[model samples]
Target: MIKLTEINKIYRTNEIETVALENVNLEVEKGEFLSIMGPSGCGKSTLLNIIGLLDAPTSGIIEIGGTRTDGMKDKQLAAFRNKKLGFVFQSFHLINSLNVLDNVELPLLYRKVSAKERRHLAEEVLAKVGLSHRMRHMPTQLSGGQCQRVAIARAIIGNPEIILADEPTGNLDSKMGAEVMELLHQLNKEDGRTIVMVTHNEEQAKQTSRTVRFFDGRQVE
Candidate 1:
């Protein structure tokens, strides 16, 4: 479902150059839940970003669901990403000013979806994530786990084919983290959504369909 060939990401300045990923080639099958495990400074998040079309590699080819993305223009990329990808960050990127339901409805605003349809879809995903009761709550009013659940609802509200989650449970306690992991597994198993998650938790990585480890910007396992 996703493929990266000899991907290389580098940050260049007039005096210095840093490599975030080097000659990394990886693939994830459709409906597979893959975990990326690595130490800090490794290229896990960088790889996830490239796969999600949020960032471009300095060199390499990326293909998602059989479409090559190497030469897509900015407009084309935006359209494609909006339709095919969903993202959940370590820090829930909710709009603080918007209530839970409104935050979950943000992604649909990019498409031509009507307000009525958007609200309905948002409500459905929130129910799926067990956040239906928190729809009217503010981010400040919810626990860390609730915030992340809302983020997941927001990510899936559009029904994207792939979900890119970066340290999804990093900020929560064990119980809450477990709850979130169970929800992610349900999404993958029941909904058949392909998930690629970056995580430092070994136990969490163990539960995924496959785990790939990275070190010093390269795939080590």
Candidate 2:
């Protein structure tokens, strides 16, 4: 469902250049749960950002669900990203001022969805994530695991084809992390949502269907 060819990403300054990804080639089939494992500074998160359309590669081609995204304009990319991709970050990036339901509804609001429809869809997604009862709770009132579940609810509210999770379990305890991973696994297996997760935990990586390791900005066997 996703393909990357000879992808290269570089950060530059007037005097120095650093490569974050080098000639990276990858393919993630539909409904596959894949883990990217790497030590610090190995470009795993960079790769995830590129795949999620949050950032562009310095050079390469990226195709997602049969659409080529390499040359899409900013507006087009933003629209495509909203329609095709979802993201979960290491930190539960929820708006503290918004309750669980409103946070989950934020994406739909940006799409110009009407209030009634947005509330309906947001509640459905919250129910799917088992957070229906926590809808009125603020982020600070939830446990780490519950907060992460709320984040997942936000991610999937749009019904995107792919979900990109960067260190999704990084902030949780082992049990909580496992719970989050299980949720992601269920999404992949039962709902057919393609997931590409970046993780440093070997055991967590093993829980996925496939694992890709990275070293020094390149995929390693």
Candidate 3:
């Protein structure tokens, strides 16, 4: 479902250049739950951002769900992301003033859905993530786990084809992390959504369909 060829991401300052991903090549097939395991500064998150179209690689080709994204214009990229990609970050990234329902419905606002339809879809996904009761509460009103669940609700509300999670469990306790992982597993195994996760936890990586390790910006395994 996703393919990257000779991907390289480099950052430049006035007099220095740093490479984040060097000659990185990878793929994730449809219906696969892939975990990226890497130490700090290994380009795992960089790779994920490129795949999700949140960032462009310095050079390389990226094809996601059969669409080439290397040269997509900004407007086209936004539309593509709205239709196909969902993101879950370690931080909840919710708008504190928006409340749960509005936060979840934010993604749909970019589309042409009516207000009623947007609310209905948001409610359904919030319920799916076990947050229906907290829909009216603000982000500050929820616990970390609840906030992440709300974030998950927001991510999936658009019915995205691919979910990219970066350290999804990094900030939660083991029990809460397990809960999130179980939810993600259901999305992958039951809903048949493709998942590519960047995680530092070995056990968590082991639970995925496959694990690919990275170090020094290179895939070592």
- What are the per-residue Cα lDDT tens digits for candidate 3 across 8-95? 9998998899899999888889988888888888888888999999999999999999889977899999999989999999998999
Over all chains combined, what TM-score does candidate 1 have? Answer: 0.96
Tens digits of per-residue lDDT for model 1 on 41-139?
Answer: 888888889999999999999999999998899999999998999999999988889999999999999889999999999999999999888899999
**Where does model 1 exceed 4 Å of error?**
210-216
Q: Write the per-residue lDDT of candidate 2 for residues 144-183, one digit (tens) a residue.
A: 9999999999999999989999999999999999889988
- Of the candidates numbered 2 and 3, which has the greater TM-score value? 3
TM-score, each model?
Answer: 0.96, 0.96, 0.96
lDDT of each: 0.90, 0.89, 0.89
RMSD of 1: 1.2
Error of 2 at 15 (Å): 2.1
* Distance from true location, Cα of 137 in model 2, Å: 0.6
Global lDDT for candidate 2?
Answer: 0.89
